[model samples]
Target chain A: MGVNIKNLSILIAAVALAGAWVGQGQADNEVVFPMPTGPLYVKECGSCHTAYAPGLLPARSWQKMMNELDNHFGEDASLDEPDRLAILRMLTDHAADNPNANMLMRRVAASIPRGAAPQRITETQLFRFQHDEVPAHIWKRAKIGSKANCGACHTRANEGRYPEREVRIPR
Target chain B: MMRLLALLFVMTTPAWATTPQQILDSLVQEARQTQSGFTASVSRGEQFYRAKQTGGKEADSCASCHTDNPKAEGRHIKTHKAIEALAPSANKQRFTDPAQVEKWFRRNCREVLGRVCTPQEKADFTAYVLSVK
Candidate 1:
């Protein structure tokens, strides 16, 4: 059993090393949000803005946001009880804590402090760190009116393809 | 046999979407139930749509985000997301779904008026929007 455990550890280490090597230059290239499949989620959340990817935040954040929909980010975004429950289920299922979460989700989960569930993805430390190079004025551009408008710079934001290669800072 | 298939298709197909007219009619019914002889006023609806109110963090009127012209596409002041024209004539999909209509009303009314809108108000608002064409 000791020998088997040693072998498993070595195997995991090799895989991690390989991943690091492949991800070295592509560090800036973020994993795009897989567009949510649920029609209700799309209709309800996407009606106003981009249906922000669920994997971007932990389960706690999703729960907090869903519970306080009446005061959602200064706008009343209340939902019927049944629809709210359905959307919440969808968000929590793909949340950062999911076992098969990608690099972005894993990083987000690691960075958030205990008992602090941020409603906005832009509030996350990782998001700020990733966008530190951007000047504050850039977010105020006519085309890129706000930092929340990911599609303004991320060409395929709606399709969840936010690769750095595709980014085009709109004037 | 062909007639039976057509009948089956009509029976099985669900009308998930309720038209703007249907929504307006339903609102009228609701308004009349509470207030006898209550007729939707397009002018009053227009006033309600453009009226500015306090208590909200950002834009006060439905017109603030929707723009003064319901025929024109509006922008979310904070998020910068493009809102399609509210006029049914300009945007065919506007007010097509019952759930969509209710959801926005529940949110927007609370934001603009700081409370839930009455059925009469909803009817008037719908009538005003529908009249824009």
Candidate 2:
């Protein structure tokens, strides 16, 4: 009986060791998406404006942005083929549908319901609410209120992303 | 010097010091307490975007006709083009009232997750969608 108890303890220790190894291995394989804007994000658009964040949309939105580059908001933000392909790959992979993604992303894709008419789009709801907090003087600025100007205040914009700190409204 | 130190201490405090996960949990619990047909299951945001109606009657989810790939053939209800990826400013008309946001949560949650969304789930979900560029 004494020998059997000792063996059992040894086996338990081995199992725990195996579990730790497996857990560590799993953590390493985890795929984190919409990695912070890379050099291209900064190099390309950052010259004129701040880069937009990748987590801004699921793959679909990125695809749309890529396709419309030829006529991007009256501006030609098109990329060199290699850069375009790379950015698209990154954005789509990090899209909002990914359930295993970070907590901030999961919430965005989950569902926030936009009401009937007057507001059928989700972004509108955000701006409507977000704008409420901003002073009207900011919106009426020399080149503001385009809505795409979200990066105006969300500074990380030019680097292909937006961060809260970049939001310095023109007085 | 003491006043400056006191000001520094106040500034250093975290605004909410809350993890996004905790916020999501709270929203999920809120959905449970409300019982307004909203679901509380938080799915992977990217999966949800590409998520086709797995067990639904028709292939007509925000993903389906919109196409599994949004860039190629997006046909979300309004956008005539291949679906424009979802964005807040892409369309402000998505929501008018706070309650309406809840309504869609209930309906879409059932459509997507096959259930209702909890408040924290919705909040988390909202954060993800809004985060998109």
Predicted complexes: DockQ each? 0.60, 0.01
Interface RMSD of each: 1.1, 13.5
DockQ of predicted model 2: 0.01
Q: Write the per-residue lDDT of candidate 2 for residues A1-171, one digit (tens) a residue.
A: 566978999989999999999886554333222454456555443433334445545555667778876444433345668777887776666665554456445544444442321111226344355457766676655445445454445444444333344467655
For A23-105, candidate 1 gives per-residue lDDT tens digits of 85365246765556847776788767876788878999999999998778877888879888989988898898778677767
Position B126, candidate 1: lDDT: 93
| Candidate 2 chain A, run of 10 with poorest lDDT | A113-122
- Please, what is the TM-score per model? 0.82, 0.37
Worst 10 residues of 2 chain B by lDDT: B75-84
Docking class of 1: medium
Tens digits of per-residue lDDT, candidate 2, B14-55, equal: 544544345445565676676665544325544555555554
Q: Which candidate has the highest TM-score of all? A: 1
